[model samples]
Target chain A: METSCHDALLFTAEHPLRLRSGATMAEVSVRYETYGTLNAERTNAVFICHALTGDAHAAGRRPGDKRPGWWDTLIGPGKPIDTDVWFVVCPNLLGGCQGTTGPSSTNPATGEPYGLDFPLLAMSDFVTVHRRLGEHLGIERWAALVGGSLGGMQVLEWILTHPSEVDNAIVIAASSRLTAQNIAFSAVGRQAIMRDPEFRDGAFQAQGTSPDKGLSVARMMAHITYLSEDGFQSKFGREAQSGELGHNFGVDFAVESYLEHQGNSFLSRFDALSYLYLTRVMDYFDPFATPDATAALAADPAKVLVVSFDTDWRFSTEHSRRIVRHLEGARVPTSFREISSPWGHDSFLLTIDDYHRTISAFMERAAA
Target chain B: METSCHDALLFTAEHPLRLRSGATMAEVSVRYETYGTLNAERTNAVFICHALTGDAHAAGRRPGDKRPGWWDTLIGPGKPIDTDVWFVVCPNLLGGCQGTTGPSSTNPATGEPYGLDFPLLAMSDFVTVHRRLGEHLGIERWAALVGGSLGGMQVLEWILTHPSEVDNAIVIAASSRLTAQNIAFSAVGRQAIMRDPEFRDGAFQAQGTSPDKGLSVARMMAHITYLSEDGFQSKFGREAQSGELGHNFGVDFAVESYLEHQGNSFLSRFDALSYLYLTRVMDYFDPFATPDATAALAADPAKVLVVSFDTDWRFSTEHSRRIVRHLEGARVPTSFREISSPWGHDSFLLTIDDYHRTISAFMERAAA
Candidate 1:
């Protein structure tokens, strides 16, 4: 299968977009990718939300691309999401760097990259763009909104803010609210980026430099949280790169080399300002903290499926349990499962038998 | 009830110290603090090893100092270690910054700070300096060697390398070998410090600048691991610093402010080069990986007590269990416990009833 990115001007100066922070964006654009085909009734559309560091490339590959989409394993012709039977639409959420009007985009006023000038965004802002994309595609309601991690946060936001438009919501490895530890980690990552001399207060492009070092450090640290301890041990257990300790500051262990590579490669594709803004979105996410936050679900409630991985310490099973309890309390039809997987938070993207089966079963019922 | 740091020259050109990495240090000075009087026989001496970022001041307030030592809660006159009965001696380890000869120390050969020129060190090197300090204090054998985290690594090394000099060993929240995840965190921290432009390849001191930003970022990340999720949740659960989200790059959550404080406070007391070297010591520590690494214990075993906290995901109870298994395999007398505490790895330094009782009982028996 092949896939190509498509960009659309979702909001223009005449129709400025208002954000959750009470800030307004004069113009907004969305980059998205679609697979399979929309049925005549257009009731088979499934919206896929990407996680942190993820883009709109949910499956297949663009021409000349060496690797398939990040979640290619689960979205092929005969696979779980089964592209043959479902029209999957994945978009780069607001405040993203992947062909979206984000921090790296040009500001009409300054005619330079938005950089730090970009308004701080919230999950609601992302859902706002997603909803626009849905309307732009002429879809009245989504058959299912599927996502994990930050993407999962988007799904929850969609169900809570626009319950009438979401027929089914699948939130995998997400949290209704971030734990203190989660916020602490995100804060440190932001510190790494902002502290970099090259960051230059997020205007590195004008300086002809990038905060690669700081961004790399942030990515490397965050990557560790995405994988399980068991997964790391099994993949790279104190294995010396040269079969002996280097006895120096260089990479001695295989894990060190792996992390260094992860850090370095990330610099080529990600933006520093976008990272800072997106992580803040996750930090401030507390949809349930507001009064009657779930009250919208009481009427045209979306069927919800919350899935968590047993070894995913990042979100953990408790995060899923909390989501289930809240939805159940709101009288929303909800199903929950804690899938056993050693891949950690990254498990959501991998091809696990039970995880795929659970999603497949849920998608089949939702599409019907 | 009072303590003062004392510096002593432990090695000189005429008597250089050889390191496990085949390098040698011509001049080495150790900084230590002693509490209580040593018995006439010197058999009451108990060596205390401070963890990473800890100094020689292990208990009692130095004259005019505001706070007591880091472990003051468990080292008072009637405390667990009981200064009234044991002559507790705590020394700043090699590759440390607390008044010890380390990367910050001037090199006699060049009349400049060693910086990156400081030879890479291992756990064995830390043990060598510690052993020299014991001899300098005229103590033939320590009644017990107690330490936690990196300090705990020192305790394990002392027993394994010089079993005859150690009567008992108390290793708390330590790992016999770091898992890949542990190494990954350390690697990211080193990357953060090294990538700082002010770091100037670890020669920031010579350039009249400091990598305070990078060091602070590293400290903030490490501080999170030192604490348990529950501890963080109860202490700073998504609480806004100003009762409302700033919705900007500044500190928004209470946890962010708390971590920023931790990162900033650490800058005044810690050195980046020392952090790098000390963490490397942990990465290379796998005493039992070598053939018959514990062979020395068969003849002159040090009774061992390995303790782990239930919430210490940094070095979980599994790590302590591994230590116990290794000791028992070597026919060494060993006791193990997983104390319930919300403090995580820092639990080893806190005042927990069962934890203190476990240590007091073990120390009492060791002294007897």
Candidate 2:
């Protein structure tokens, strides 16, 4: 899944601006990576948005990393986000666990971590940066913009906020809004973080302490939501994990191992503030709030694709269609597909042969 | 989902004998509520095993409680486990949140709340108590022992430990072994409780303190795994449960509210120690340890009825089938059925119609 960075420069985007909260961030650095070389006509740009914990690194086995990109199998030389012909660009999301200016990033003014002090970034703010990234490359519009889960939300928000910035938008396993339940989960996570003695109320920037336990608990909670019972049961029922429960509460279940891995690993490259900021973004997302707000996107609706998985209880297919219905009602050229995957919402990260084919075909059309 | 329990009698089983672990136990007190009349032939007695947090009260609608017994729909006077026919007995499991002796029960020796000092009881211990309860009532054996989740574990163990104790067992949304993942989850819950300052290393007994935060976290963690993602998506989504979370991680999703309700109410009635014990019981459940273990069952082999819900990913129907296959191979009269529900592992508690019929059919066979 490795493509030469210098050779695969399909496009580049960057910008700096004032946020909705009246906070100005200058030269907001957005270092992104792309796949495939663009034609002279420059009409084949496909903007792929990464999710909360994702990065510009989408489909590759990067050096120094033991594992490949989150969805390397699905996007390679001839993979779904095929670099064979279509230009696919993936940027590290703003307020993310990756290399964008996030909570973990040093605050230029304070010379300290932004933590919660980082201007409260919204999902719209994320799309705004995305639009700027697209504009910096001198591209009038993208052939398509795609993402899954939270990434999917950015795609929907991108279309809703700047409908003309792209020709098509694909949202997979994304929801119309962050329900109270989702927020409650995020809140609990945040609570876990804030309550962590190390967190110091998000002001622990100077301490360089990561609220590992709190974050682990948060991730554990999120992990539970991401998979279905069929997935969890098939993966890890009451099966004993290890260390004999330590005669005390230690790690036991495979699920716990998985969640602990996610949480601990998250603290390494991810910022606690980024979790706070990004979760807030998801909580505030509303794809169908108003006519001028979201319904109005149809006037020049970007061709949109919404896909959902049957077993993905996290952001079920119904969520995908809700986006499609709004897109269609707005006279947007939209395609809706419901794929079946027993892996739950995480299927987007897995290369279901059918999913790959579908993505490849969609990219082909977007390129044309 | 309401019924009068006037005809039912509550029975307390003797807690005599040293448990599997040499611990001073008096007559095992099993505070059970029974419905329906036992026939002269004494062949109509049926045992109902309640889930982890369920109680001996099966089908009573309190004037202001608003919520009936979790199994009110199925165990009513004319319902499937109909009090009108087979004599039904629902016993408070050995270590439960209800009237049964749990962590909250007074220690006869210490004359104080047992709390964590309460002996760590296993699933087999629950079965032992059930057997004693049945014996005291002159019930040579049950027509069938019906249970879901943890209760199902008891039913399975009852058949394996004392095959003659139950002619048939209806194990629902339960498993034969504690998956490593489930153990890990329980580990986190235990950790959460232990970490709470109020918990004081499970020595909160003398202080009159309860590990509210830890217990709540435990409940919150467990609650998330109990439902299907499809259930969460349909029920919560990013919707502002009651018009909130537009900006914060507060209770913005209905799922969060539901989880909160579960977690909050749990701390009130549940003993954090019992939660630890019961989950461990689940962790220790392994019905297929050795074939010889089954060879000892009564020559007629107890009839086994295994049931699971399609949506119960926590305990997939496959898990139940594994039990059916094992019991049947042992020449135990066995039946397997997978009921349909969207409630995930908790489906048995909510969707009782199909199970009601299944239990009724199995009980009728046992009566005959």
Candidate 3:
């Protein structure tokens, strides 16, 4: 499962790329990592899109690295998205902080980090940048587009936006559009980041201060949604901290400690403003919102495989069902399944046998 | 459905009222509201416990009030728990902010608000205070003890603490103990309040400042949990805030606006320190953890009716099942039903036909 270092790809828009918010931006840079080799016909290229906080690192360990890539379990030499047969390219999304043109990227007009100056991007904007990245790599089409959660949102958008560019798509633990409850959670997460006085109106970079607490709180709030109640109870029950109760406001339960750790550790790698922008993209995502949703979906050319977990309340099976129903209504080739897993929405990222098996079979069929 | 003003009762403890945290305060003031008349046998009094964020107001309107009481739908003359047939008493919980001796109540020794100086309390402490309020009213035994959420927690505690004092008990949307996920949310809420630099380590009262944003965030988080996904989707959906999208972080979705309103309005009524204290009480609740759980349940002479909403993920039906299992295991009279409702944990407060009917039938039988 060895992985290589990430490669930065400059994608300067020849013309201003107008955003959904009616703004335009240019000179976008997208960083990506590739594993395996593109076949001579360039037919075996698989594009992997990342979730909200994910990066281009999808598998393997870097030099002197102790942690494997996030999806290492499914993207290694003989893994589900086997690198031996498929040339896998994982790109950090636009409006992402990790080695990508995002809120932290420099604003060419001002010679400073874009910060709040970064254009409000929709899921379509993210797909547009990734499409440019793909075309730059000399690929005519993607053999498959695979993603989970926010990444899955991109996969749905890609199939709709560039039908001929992708042959097969795997949308796992994702939604076509967020429900009101979904939007509510995102709103709170954004509020947590914005309310921190240290945010300095999203120009904390210039002020040399970080909204660490707010971002931490935001991450903690999101973390709670990522896992199921059973997952939390199993991992950290009412199990008292230090095997004894502390009557004060400190971490009294194991879940509190776990959430605190998740919140603190996330602050080191993620940008707060990027969190705001990316989550907004999720909130605005609604490919099915138009009047002719069926006709719009019917135009998608990819063979779609959709997966959700039974316990994944964050992006429940109902979300997957909605996508499948829409796809079926559009007469698209779609395979949908709700896998049973205790891990909740995070089951897609873990080493679950059924999860891997279902995707592997679907990928094989797509490849054949 | 009319209402009356609240009456304040003071109990100067000859001995300190010991808390689960091993601390004690002597002078305690309990503010309560009573409707209807006590029966000649003094057994027709129904004790109503309030949840977190709820006050002593349960039914009827205050002087010149436009809005009816919170539980006015079910606690009036011809309502489910008819005030005609039963006397009702609702009390502001210990450590509550609503005219009760709580964090905002002045500390006798220091002649200042207790703030964080208020001794950390447990569910047992809350139950103890209400029991005193009952005795002060000269009730030999309550006809029934009913509550929802934290109020439900108190109901369970009272049943266990004084088996003979309560004749019947109805626990709704409550848990015998807090799940790890439950504790996680509470911890984050407390963190939201505590991390606000303005909190001043809970000395905000003395400092003449309030952790308004933090408390607001906390309320918003809890508000999300109180309603089910179906509940939110139906109520708000993807409705835009202004029939158009706003590219900024201010409230955009209808749910966002609703949550923001809920959070902001909650700040005017709830105390940050009490939010911390009460949620801690919930986190520390673990009645089944003790070795005497079987003995404790066996000792309860009350007829217990436990109700849960199918859509209530916050305190799911599983929580109610756990309580019923324990009571049944101890050979206590227990009736349990998981009522179907789209309102989630707040179903108990809403006007659900089956829900009201179930409680009405049970209360009638208990009175009989």
- How many collisions per candidate? 0, 37, 3
Report fnat, model 3. 0.75
Model 1 agreement with the true structure over A92-209: per-residue lDDT tens digits: 9788899889988999889998888889898999989889999999999899999999999989988998999989989999998999999888989999999888999888987789
lDDT of 3 by residue, B137-209 (tens): 8887888999999999889988987888888999999999888888888888888888888899888998999
Residues B1-368 of candidate 2: C-alpha lDDT, one tens digit per residue: 33333221222235354566666566345677777788998888888888877778877665787677778777777666777877888877776767677777777778887777777676777776777667668899688788889888888877787775567777888888765446666666766666566776666866888777667777876776687656766777655568655454455566667777877888777787777777877776676875676775646577777888887766777778888777777787778888887778877877457767887787666656
Question: For each model, chain A TM-score?
Answer: 0.98, 0.91, 0.96
TM-score of each: 0.98, 0.79, 0.96
> What are the lDDT scores of the predictions, listed in order?
0.91, 0.72, 0.86
Interface RMSD (Å) of candidate 1: 0.7
Error of 2 at B226 (Å): 4.1
Among residues 3 or more apart in sequence or in different chains, the pairs in candidate 1 whose N, CA or C atoms overlap within 3 Å are: none
TM-score of 3: 0.96
- Model 3: pairs clashing at backbone N, Cα or C within 3 Å: B2-B60, B3-B60, B3-B61
Docking class of 2: acceptable
Best by TM-score: 1
* Model 1 TM-score (B-chain only): 0.98
Best model per DockQ: 1
When sorted by DockQ, best at the front, the candidate numbers are 1, 3, 2
